[model samples]
Target: MILWFTIVQIAVACAAGLFCLIAGLIGRRPSDYTVGSLLLVELLLLAQVVIGIVAPLTGNPPTGDLLEFWVYLIAAVLLPIGGIAWALLERGRWSTVVLGVVAISLAIMLWRMQVIWTVQVA
Candidate 1:
């Protein structure tokens, strides 16, 4: 994994988490901006998946166990999918709460990814 890109992803995830929390607190539904940010995060995650696969293919062994890597990747991909689904199911603050959950999940995955990267580097 690219260190810089991972850092960027972590930062973005934290910000999104904060925004989601605020939205939930204010009893506000997700706005276009919120959805757009989540989509952007997912896009970045997809890029990470590609890069992660390519790195291993090119003879760079993964930092974590293959199962761990796959788990993180799956969780990363599912966050946005879940967010979209929850947004559709609820119309207001509840939807934002769901988004907050997504953000938290994204942050956790990013941290796990970082740990994997560190293990790989060591």
Candidate 2:
């Protein structure tokens, strides 16, 4: 796991979470902007997955237990998938709520990844 990339993911997740909270407070739905941001985050995670796979192949120690790493990766990817699905099924404040869930889940997964990476390194 690249430290800077992980940091970036954390920052993005926080920003998305904040947006979700604000939208909820204002009683507004998630907009195109929210979806776009989620998509961007997903894309970044996909890139990270590719980099992670390549890194291990190049002789870097695997960042964590392979199964744990894969679980986190799948969860990260699934957040946006869930977000998109919910967005399609609901509108208004409910959409924002769905996004909030996605953001929080992403944050949790990223933190877990960090912890696992640390354990592996140690």
Clashing pairs in 2: none
Candidate lDDT values, in order: 0.79, 0.78
> Candidate 1 at 101: error in angstroms?
2.3
TM-score, prediction 2: 0.88
For residues 40-108, write the lDDT of model 1, one tens digit per residue.
Answer: 789889998898889877876766677777788887898798897778677788787777778777878
Q: Candidate 2 lDDT, tens digit per residue, 7-68?
A: 89988887887787678668877788877777777887888788778877777656568788
Which segments of model 1 are wrong by more than 4 Å? 120-122
lDDT computed for candidate 1: 0.79
Position 110, candidate 1: lDDT: 83
Quick one: best lDDT, which candidate? 1
Worst 10 residues of 1 by lDDT: 113-122
